[model samples]
Target chain A: MNEKAYFSEQIRLYEQNIYGLALSILKNEHDAADVMQDAILKAYSSLHTLRDRRKFKSWILSIVHNTAIEHLRRQKPTIDIDEQYDLAAPEPTVDPETRHTVRAAIEQLSLAHREVIVLYYYENYSTGQIAEILDLPPATVRQQLFRARKALSKHLNKEDFDR
Target chain B: MTTPSDRDIRRQLEAEGRPAVPDFVHQMTEATLAALPEKLPVQRRPSPFKRISAAAACAALLMLGVLPNVSPAYAQAAGRIPLLGSLIRVLTIRNYTYDDGSHLLEADIPHVEDDDNAEAAALINADIDALTNAAVSRFYHELELSGQGYGSIHIDYETVTATDRWFTLQLRVTETAASSTTYLKYYHIDRQTGRHVGFGDLFAPDSFAALEAAIRAEMQAQMDADPQIDYYIEDEQPDGAPTTLSADQPFFFTENGDLVIVYDKYTIAPGSMGNPAFTIPKSVYEPLLK
Candidate 1:
């Protein structure tokens, strides 16, 4: 296949996933859109050099992550300790305050830890998959997951499970 | 009584409603496609002979014998042109102008091409020295390879391109012992405009023997040039060996002035070198540079 067709096909396959990744990181829809636009511009501009087509998904995802980080660093958006509850999560049983508390607790964790949580929890990535996506060792991914779990546990410990 | 297990957190987060993604995403692919230069106007209804010519053009691209000259432009556009490998820490591009004017970009390398010629040259020199050190160290370790008749010996740097907004650096290395050459180029991409303003090339000759001879000659020259400078300071033998080390080997200088040499097959002295001329003390460096 010609280069343009090949790249456009790749873009179609991964567009939603890339968008989802950006959304998880940026939180706000508008910011996520901006990140997505920038990432796609970059991806399309550099599409010719993908040596291993098999790894394209992961490669695109990495670009998105780095682009999001760059945008976030520039903006330095303020995170409300309470806004963490917007995990966009469907835990309706949990009270708003409690959910917010748990999210806030998750937010308090370092960026490294937060990335693992976002990947595993929101993106539904397996440990091995997450390892490749983040360019981290498997052991490191597992450790971050373990720490994220521990942090969540501490927050839930202060409130009842049913409430 | 639902427990918030790892799987549960994942499920809950995934279950939440995702906001509508912006419209620009779907448009991005189209925009990029639109930006492409129009193909040369060829006859639409070519005869069978013309079709054969088209097929021949495609075939030529795949011919293994013609590998080197096949338009590096594709690789650069693909962003797969290994921006960096061993020996290169960074690549920064300078000023960039878009023919289509879709995006114009410019980048600033802290150590290169800022109105200060002396400062930029010194930074570039240090970068070269660090790369040299890496090449020498790699030669040092490749020598330790067991039962191998093969060895490599060439190392050098090349300038890919330097402009006001775009700079390209390619770190080229060849290992004769391994019968392979690695090419890595780092692009300091400009944020404001999408251009690379500067570039670097870190290359080694194809033969281990040649690489070694060249390194020894370079080191000897450096040593003889400044006999007054101490070549064998404390910890010169980073691994506690009595062998001496040189500072020109792309040594890593932390913000704190810690000197660490990152050569092929070797990484030495994490936090020992005194202040480097490139760096101000942390108290001063942080406030000014950061």
Candidate 2:
């Protein structure tokens, strides 16, 4: 296949993964759309720069990750530490009624923790793959995964009670 | 009340439907695909030994004083040899490419070394190489720190004018991070004295004010004549008056000898304006030319 056709097919194959990753990082549907658009355009323009065709999936995911982070940085220059640490105290509760609540709780986690959880649990990427995509150390990814699970559990428990 | 188990969380996450690709994304991708060039840029990989041989041959020819008697076709043929094929007069000496998956650099660089203007040529070539190398190293350094996405730097050049008396080279260095940004630089050489020239060398001393005024008037007049052509004068100066061109402002001479002033993106207008350039007729600056 031609370069454009190949690129288009790659985009089609990974469109859902790209969008899901962007949405997980950005936590807003509209922002995720914008990031996806920007990342796709960027990937298309610089396709020649991709030396390894085998790593195309991870390569594009890295672009999306960076683009979303850049967008978030531009939107809010300074992140709130208190907001990240304000995890709800976990309480024993029955399983939630809908997956929507769990997804919403995931979105409530800080950008750093949320991304690791989504990549690990949702995308099923290994810690090494997540670390590579996020440009974090494996140790950091594991720590993030640990913290993210706690935050999610607490947030879901609280979310269930609030509902 | 009990917290959900990791298995339950994973199941719930898996159950979460994949976000649908927005309709606009598909439309935008299609539009982008349609807009892309039919052929991807050809990656030229000229071997180093061949380049050295070509340069040695050219230098030997120059030392033998054979270039003057040689046919233009022979001169042109020399350029088609290998690496430095185009470097004899106004050609790219090296179009370097480096891609290690994470970082990529492509530079179309010039190498000019006239027997008469050897010093000036060497200085200009060194300067260009230094700039390109610095940009490459900086990009690599940045990528090393933030290895999130691919980083690239492209350095392409255009020979604006190549006359016996004057030679002007325009270099565009585009560095891509999340988005691509381009910076423009111009190199001018006085072939006779073998001296690198800048804005100051082009005109008579004390003639800068008149030249600036003339350029501003011409740009403003052009903007007034064409609705599609709007400069950033209004955005730059709230009063909407043309700002005086700086003495060291970037510029080049067209083959017709007209002065073309170039502004980097976001300097005079929004990036949509994209490196705005205004050409002033030769007649306007005739008296000012040194």
- The clash numbers for all candidates, in the given order, read 61, 5
lDDT (tens digit, per residue) of candidate 2 on B1-290: 25566777766655665567778766765675566555543221211111123343344334324322212122232232222234336556655566766567776666665566677878777667656545544454454434445568887777777765667777788876654557787887876677887776676557767776765676689667875444544344212324556555678887677888876553444333466777768888887777
Error of 1 at B169 (Å): 17
Compute the lDDT for candidate 2. Answer: 0.64
lDDT of 1 by residue, B1-290 (tens): 22357655544444553334457756764675555433311111111111223333344233313333212121122122222232122323211111112211121111233222334445454444343333333333333321122234343234453444333343444433212223232323332343332311121222223333333454456457854222222444223322232212222224244222223221111111121112223343222221
User: What TM-score against the true fold does each predicted structure earn?
Assistant: 0.40, 0.46
TM-score of chain A of 1: 0.66
Clashing pairs in 2: A92-B1, A92-B2, A93-B1, A93-B2, B79-B85
lDDT of 1 by residue, A49-152 (tens): 34357767866777677677667755765754325322333223334454444444455555566667767765567765666566444555686687667656
DockQ of 2: 0.12
Cα deviation at B34, candidate 1, in Å, is 4.6
Of candidate 1 chain B, the 10-residue stretch with the lowest lDDT total is: B41-50
- lDDT for B255 (candidate 2): 67
